[model samples]
Each structure stands twice: as C-alpha cells, then as structure tokens.
Target: MARPPLRNDLIEEITTRVLDGRLAAGARVNEVHLARELSVSRTPLREALIGLAGRGLLTAEPGRGFLVPPFDPDEARRLYTLLAELEALALRWTSPLELAGLPDAVDAVADEMVAALERGADLSEVDDRWHALLLSRCPNPHLLRLIEQTKPLLKRYEWCYFGGVPRAGESIGEHRRIAAALREGDLSAASAMLVRNWVSTVAFLRKDNGDQCASE
Candidate 1:
C-alpha cells in the first residue's frame, strides 16, 4: 500500500493530462513549466517524460524535448485492435472461480456509468473502472501491465468518443451484454463482446473523423 516512487507518480500525472486533452495532441511539452507546476525538479520531470516517450505516450525529438503525438486514425485503429486482443486474452486467462462474482461487479459499475450520464458527467473514469473490474481477477501481472501501458495510447480518442452522450450510453449497453455473457458462465462470449466493444469504437472513430487527420 505504499506510494509509488515520485518518478512513477510523475508519469501518471502527465499521462492524465494527455488523456484529458490538457496537454493536447502534437503540442510540445514545456518541461520547465511542468516542473514548476508540479513542484518538482527538472531532473525527475525529464526522466518521467523520457519514460512516457518510451511508452508511446509522448514523443522525444532530437532538440524538442517531449511532444504529445498527434492523433492518427490509423494508429488508433491498430492500438484499439491490439488492446482488444490483449483484454480478451486477460479475460480468458482469469480463473473461473475468481470471475464468479464479476458479472455483478461489472453491472454495478455500469450503474455508475448510467448515473454519470444522467447527470451529464464524463463516463471515462467509470468506463475505466468497469474494465479494471472485469480483469481484476487475472493472475497474469505481465499481461495486466501491458494492457495498462497500451490503454493510454487510445485514451484521448476514447475521451472524444465518449464525449457524445449517446455514444457513451451505447457503450453502457455493450457493457451490459458482456456482463450478461459472464453471468451465463460464457467466458468466450464475454471475451467476444469485449472485443466487439473495442472494435465498434474504432469503427465509430473512423466514421466520425473521416478523412480529416488530427492537427500535429
């Protein structure tokens, strides 16, 4: 229960900014400003940026320090597909006993998503919670860590995807179906539903964005 090292904390903090669109795609990260704002020395902040760059959450240029990568629909498609497989594998690897109560837990998180939507709140946090719950029983730490690392790459797009309240509501329905599959003790069906959820998002983004590439 101890706190993570300051470097890890800094990485999460910066990743959150990127996810929420505060850092924004294609914008150069101002190391001095961030270090000052976070009340940390430049050394640790730089290290964190380097780590994020290594993780594909940030880009490192020869002389430009760190930059937020622009949102590329093709890249998003690839990441979404990769994440879908990873998550499905995680679900399959999870012990059946550990998943016995997962359907109810997932449904409860879906309820939270419903409440968030009803009040015009963002669904991203609740959505994240639901996925984390779905895979919480997976015994493979390495797979879980890979999923964790890959998710942020698509979060900015997800934030935009869920910005449409109607789309967010549709996602809730998808979650329910996945939960239902779990309730029926159908892990294969549940995994398929989960993958469909991700696939549908990718299709939606492609249609929504069309030929317009995000500004870099």
Candidate 2:
C-alpha cells in the first residue's frame, strides 16, 4: 500500500527543501517550526522525517531528532555509480518486446522536459517521469526499488550542480537517443546510453565540485 497523502506531501516538500538547499546540510530540523511553516501536523511531519532518513537525506538521532546529512561529493558520485549499475541491470533484464510499446511514454515525458527547459521552469518532476518511463520495461521489482531509493540523494547532487543550467537540453537529446535505440530493439545501445547518461552526470557534478577525479 502507498503512504498517506499527507505523509507523502510532507516528504516531498521536505525533500525539495533539502535538495534546493533551503534546508541546508547539517542543519537540525526544528519540528515545531517546520510543522508550523508547512501547515502540517507533528504526526505527518515526523513520518516524513523518518521517510527522508530512510532515503539517506536525513540523520535521525534518538534524542536530537533529525538533521540534514552533509552532502559529500564523493559519496554522491558513488551513489550515482550505483544507480547507473542498477539501471543497467534493469535494461539487461528487460527484453525487447517488453519495451516495444513504451517509447511513447518516454517520448511524451521528454517532450515535457523540453518544454520545461524552454520555459525555464523546474524539470525535476518531468525528468523523473522520463526516467521512470524509460525503465518501466524492466521486470525486476528489486532493481526498481533500488533505483527509487537512490533518487533523493541523486537529486541533491543535481540541484547542487545542474540547477539553473542548460543541462536539460542535452539530456533531452540523450533521452531521445536511448528511447530510439530501445524502439529499434537495440538493448545494448540503449543500455549503453543509459549508463553514459548517468556517468556523464557524475562527471559533470564532479567538475562542478572541482574534484580531482573529474578528469578520471
């Protein structure tokens, strides 16, 4: 079963705050203040904090409650690496027939992403939809769950490095190429593109962070 709507909404709201740095890393969450600010109650707010903790966005202490975890660039790169590997596994396990009918959904989401980019609007939700559709052909529930688990951490890196940048335009082209490859039943090509997409994302983030490993 899905989480309650209030809990889910609180979770998303808190996540956005964390990703965009409104809730800075290492900052302690004042439950009362946050609940009043968000117009939510303690129960759902606590549930949201617990959910975020599970997603690696928050550290929950027995007496101190929750605090945003410090963003570690190396750890972010490692998470992206893991995400790429799991997504590649999904592509490998998905047969051509499983994806023959899914390109339309992927393309539609890509179109929305493009529109959002052109309008200088937030593309996070559309970007999520695009990737979710791209991997919908994968039949492994565990792989899917793992992919979902890494998204919050990945999005924090994205917000830190890619926000207000034109990265989405290039990403749309990559998305199209992957979708086209999948439509042609070229699993290898599609999987390669998916991995490249994620690897390139890590590279870009590293460069933005001025990491020595960016050249590596």
Candidate 3:
C-alpha cells in the first residue's frame, strides 16, 4: 500500500510504538513487516524509514534492513537541550512577534489534552499533536529543523511515559504553565517552564528507561 506524505503524524505513530517498547528497540522493520504491522504497503513504509532515519530514530545500514536505533543518553540530552535553546530563543530573542494565531492553535491541542486527562486518556497522541503545534510556530527555519529532527526522539520518550507504562502526571501542570506563558508572551516564564519541564521529566524517566548517563 502507498502511504501519503510520510507525514509527521505517521512517523510519530511508528516512533511512539518503538520508543514505548511496544515494537522493541533493535527490532527489525523491513518493508513487509511494517507494511503488515501498519496496514500499509512497502512504499509508505520505505518513506517512513527514510524519514525516521533522517530524524535519527532509525538507522539504515548497508546490506541490512532498518532497525530501531538504540537509545543514547548523551544524544538524547543533547537533542533535548538543543530543542530547549531553540525554543527559548524563539520565545525570548524574537522581537515580540505577535502571537495572533498561536493561542487558538495552542488551545486546540491543550483542550484535547485536558480531555484526555479528564477521561484518563492515553496521552501519547495528544502529546505528539500538542508539541507539533507548539514547535511549528517557531519563527526560524533552523529552529524548526532542530525541532523536526528531535520530535521522533522526544516522541519516543513521551510514548514511553504516556503509554501503558503508567507514568505519573506531574508534567501535565508544567505543560499548562508553558501554555500560559506563551499566551501571555512571557518569554522568561516560557523558557523557565520549558527547562523545568524537560529536566524534571528526564529525571523521572532516568531510573529504568535506560542507562543513567553522565549527561543528566
């Protein structure tokens, strides 16, 4: 089957599954296997693999098929830190770009998240969509690319935390705080919120998710 666009949504879905340990890291994902798993065909799966490889979520080796890239603590921290800097810069250094349409975009996703929380909904999809909206508004291409490259990796962690692994919901309030800061155009608050959110979540997951690398 043909997959359309290899869009962020599809890639996020696959990345989430793999990261949440649902697919198992280092597991194979050939065209046929993923096609069967995803209910799509080889073409779309190939496109997805290419997209993920570019994002660093999957590695494609010569003469070998695609496999889930092992989690690297340093790489993960660097990617998240880079994202934090880019996002904080976008919030701080940009000359007060009027967030004319941002609140609506933010609210839409936040509302979905709120509902998920209300129903004790699984939050991975909501997390993916919310971050997608938050990052897409960034004004710089370099920043956007940084975000794009990190989304899959972050999505993996988010999926692990939000998937059936049963993580606590402490970050929920932090996300709300970031939304409030963005709404109010409080760069300091937004930056602080992002840093705190990233750091705290990373701390929470470090216990059993992977090796406790020197980075954290």
The model with the greatest TM-score is 1
lDDT tens per residue, model 3, 140-163? 887777766666676554432322
lDDT digits (tens) for residues 125-199 of candidate 1: 898999999999999999999999999887767644433876787889999999999888899999999999988
Scored by lDDT, the top model is: 1
Cα RMSD of predicted structure 2: 4.9
Residue pairs whose backbone atoms clash in candidate 2: none
10 residues in a row with least lDDT, candidate 1: 207-216
Higher-ranked by lDDT: 2 or 3: 2
- Clashes (N, CA, C under 3 Å) per candidate: 0, 0, 1
- lDDT against the true structure, per candidate, is 0.87, 0.80, 0.65
Ranking of all candidate structures by their lDDT, best first: 1, 2, 3
Model 3 regions more than 4 Å off: 1-23, 31-51, 93-97, 100-112, 162-169, 182-185, 211-216
Q: State the lDDT of candidate 2 residue by residue for 1-216, as single tens digits.
A: 554458878888898898777887778999999988887778889988998898888999889999987767888778878888888889889877888988778998888988888888888788888878778878899889888878887776665465245566777888999889988888899888988887777656645463432222
lDDT of 2: 0.80
**How many pairs in model 3 have backbone atoms within 3 A of each other, for residues 3 or more apart or on separate chains, i.e. clashes?**
1
lDDT, residue 100, candidate 2: 92
